[model samples]
Target chain A: MDSEYKKEDFLLLFGSRIDIIRRKKGYSYERIAQGCNIDGSDISKISKGRVNITLSSILELSKGLDIHPKELFDFEIEA
Target chain B: MDSEYKKEDFLLLFGSRIDIIRRKKGYSYERIAQGCNIDGSDISKISKGRVNITLSSILELSKGLDIHPKELFDFEIEA
Candidate 1:
């Protein structure tokens, strides 16, 4: 497929978006991780774009943050 | 977290949505997999809710189907 969206590009953008959301809510990675029943390191990895996160993890993060799942997915794309 | 959204429920809904999109686009798993350079078995697994697919994969599917990424993420929630 003639696609312009690279995997790493999307991952980085997604990570940055999550980080922004986390900061906006004043929630640390550890706190969010504990609330979501996920490891802090995994959350860190996701924020660092070092690992691929599952859909369950994404929704769990939203649940932990007391936000809607769609909010987690809301991001502006420049690419 | 008071999430009425269960992990299994979302996965099933997601898989079903993807399946519906595939059918609506008139594209088979094999054809889509071939177009996106993904394995047909993996596509089947995603559609069957037997595996967790990455965000990149979901985007690649949209690319393969000649649609937007947001469209892949779109679904009418009945829960």
Candidate 2:
């Protein structure tokens, strides 16, 4: 289904999906942040839909999770 | 190999990949932007490595390109 998303909806869905992926990989936000060398607070914000997550951020997050970057997009994300 | 990237290298690679995808889809920057309801100038800038492209932006771009978001990460991106 082609769903139109506002930036807010998009961010919310992205955060939820990232949260799911982090949990599935058995990583705490702090651990993943450490792996990514990003701030833990920033990771928490990203997971809570409080920031505009960049492509580089996704790549770093996937790297931290030890998964293909594409795997991050492999789910249905609800707004 | 785990490629540790600077933000600049990351942006360049992301732009290159986006350009490759846009071309593979036979889309001009204008048309895809139209489809995504985004600014054409911004799309052009994105392809030029001038933006810190967001996850939501990628989703909209994939929608515009009529491809899976995962497809955007299908190739190896060089710095």
Across A12-36, the per-residue lDDT of candidate 2 in tens digits comes to 7767888898888788888887778
**In candidate 2, which residue ranges exceed 4 Å CA deviation?**
A1-3, A77-79, B1-3, B77-79
DockQ of candidates 1 onward, in order? 0.44, 0.53
Off by over 4 Å in 1: A1-4, A76-79, B1-4, B76-79
Interface RMSD for every prediction, one decimal? 3.0, 2.5
* Docking verdict class for candidate 1: acceptable
Model 1, A1-79: lDDT tens per residue? 3477787877787788789899999988898876676777788888877766777887687776777556665665554
**Clash-forming residue pairs, model 1:** none
lDDT of 1 by residue, B1-79 (tens): 4556777877777788779888998989888886685788888888877777777776677667766555655764443
